[model samples]
Target: VEMMENVSKYRYANVPNLDAQVVEIPYADGRLSMVMMLPNREGLHSLQTLFRDLSYSPLASTLASLRETELLLQIPKFSIESKLNLRPTLEALGIKDIFGFDANLSGILAGKSAQIGSVLHDAKIEVNEQGTVAAAVTGISVIPLMGSTMDTFRADRPFLFAIVDQSTGSMIFAGRVVQPTWAAPSPLG
Candidate 1:
């Protein structure tokens, strides 16, 4: 288990809708960040339901509202990685032609006959005191894509998180942790 059972300060914010205080772990570049959402209560699914109810626009706005606060942060050390074959999921989104027998990916390869046999999205991230290191590689695929002053944002329980792109306001990588040792293994592994 990646245990981050230590206390430290970070940029924090109190978000009303999520009922969680947020802490931003910025990258060296500042264009991206690791946004962790630690709910004031132990209701992780409630946080999920709120996001599902509000959609992402509200999320982008919510993130924009973060400010500095003194925070006693207690979060676990975890690495999140996932590999998923996007064929069925893509097809469900009306992207069938690409997976069809006569699919046309001509524009992709000059004359070679090639269909998008399968699209896989592999993403992983690691976060710690020295800052956060993250990367996402979408195999033939494509894809936080913030916080403030004195507050206690202890994530000793399940919570949600995302790696967002500041400029585009898109979540490049996002997931929730139900277990500390196994990243998102409780439900996602």
Candidate 2:
């Protein structure tokens, strides 16, 4: 709570598009970026279900249509550490032998049969008032409010995000924040 109190708050335009609202923060050199996707209160479930479809066209479209509005940005400060066991998920996708006894990796190791014992993916992220605690460049934009009346975009609930390489437009990291926190970060985060 003390950390949250000192966060540098900003008021900008918060445009609402189709299913979710978005904000893109580019890296200092424009070679990397972070994109935040906050879904409508009612669209959370649908967004989660659709996130796995590599072609995030719907998300792209919504971002391209942003029109800036009033926003009270106060994303809570949090850190996440997670591990994912990919053996099961991979096998289900038809990637079997690598984790089975029948695996054949002899070319790399002449006489030894090398089979993957386990596949573990570990990731960590921290976001606070200063910015994302990541090992890359990312940029941010502040859109001024157009009129006296303004809308707010506060990320106090579940939201999705991605860290991408702008040069190649490849996602380096992606996940959701179902319950943003330091101690109990969600796997989605």
Using TM-score, give the best candidate's number: 1
Candidate 2: tens digits of C-alpha lDDT, residues 48-98: 743643264654454455554334344556577889999899999999988
On lDDT, the candidate that comes out on top is 1
TM-score of 2: 0.62
Listed in order, each prediction's TM-score against the native is: 0.73, 0.62
The candidate 2 region of ten consecutive residues with least summed lDDT is 2-11
Q: Model 1 reaches what TM-score against the true structure?
A: 0.73
Residue-wise C-alpha lDDT for candidate 1, range 1-189, written one tens digit per residue:
543322233456777766667777666687987788776666557666645644643667777777765344456667778999988998889989977778787888788776777899898876654446222111121110124333565576777788888788788888888754333211110
Instruction: Write down the lDDT that model 2 would get.
Output: 0.56
Instruction: Count clashing residue pairs per candidate.
Output: 20, 8
